[model samples]
Target: MWNSQSIVQQQQRLAHVLAIVQDLKALSMLPLLTNLDLIQEIQTISTATRPFIPSPTNGLSLSTELF
Candidate 1:
């Protein structure tokens, strides 16, 4: 869990990024590629910090009961 100060800083960073996205929206009219490209870029950044996600087990888990 994030501390309050860390959460606040993250929210501030998100606001800054959202402002940038809003600014970018004005420059392009091709709707699909812009968002897709941004998503790919964010994914690349995340993959650098974390392992690639595993495939899901077709909605089944080995654990039959919650503890």
Candidate 2:
């Protein structure tokens, strides 16, 4: 007996699980992750995993200006 609300709830739960899995995947790379390499890997992962957003919207961007 699946309703639309139930389907939405399940989708939300799946999204939550996916977020956890991504974090675990990153953590699992730690032992072999060097400081510089790890930073690069994390930046790549973060950019790829994040959802797309339009300009003039509330979202983060991959800033090119290095501090």
- Tens-place lDDT digits, model 2, residues 1-67: 9999999999999999999999999788799878778667656776675643335664434544333
Cα displacement (Å) at residue 49, model 1: 45
Task: Please name the candidate that would achieve the greatest TM-score relative to the true structure.
Answer: 2
Q: Which TM-score value belongs to model 2?
A: 0.52
lDDT of 1 by residue, 1-67 (tens): 8899999999999999999999888557456557668657656765666543534865322332233
User: Which candidate tops lDDT?
Assistant: 2
Model 1: lDDT equals: 0.65
The per-residue C-alpha lDDT of model 1 at residue 59 equals 32
Q: What TM-score does prediction 1 earn?
A: 0.40
Q: CA RMSD for every model?
A: 11.5, 10.1
Pairs clashing within candidate 1: none
- Each prediction's TM-score against the native? 0.40, 0.52
Query: Each candidate's lDDT (Cα)?
Result: 0.65, 0.73
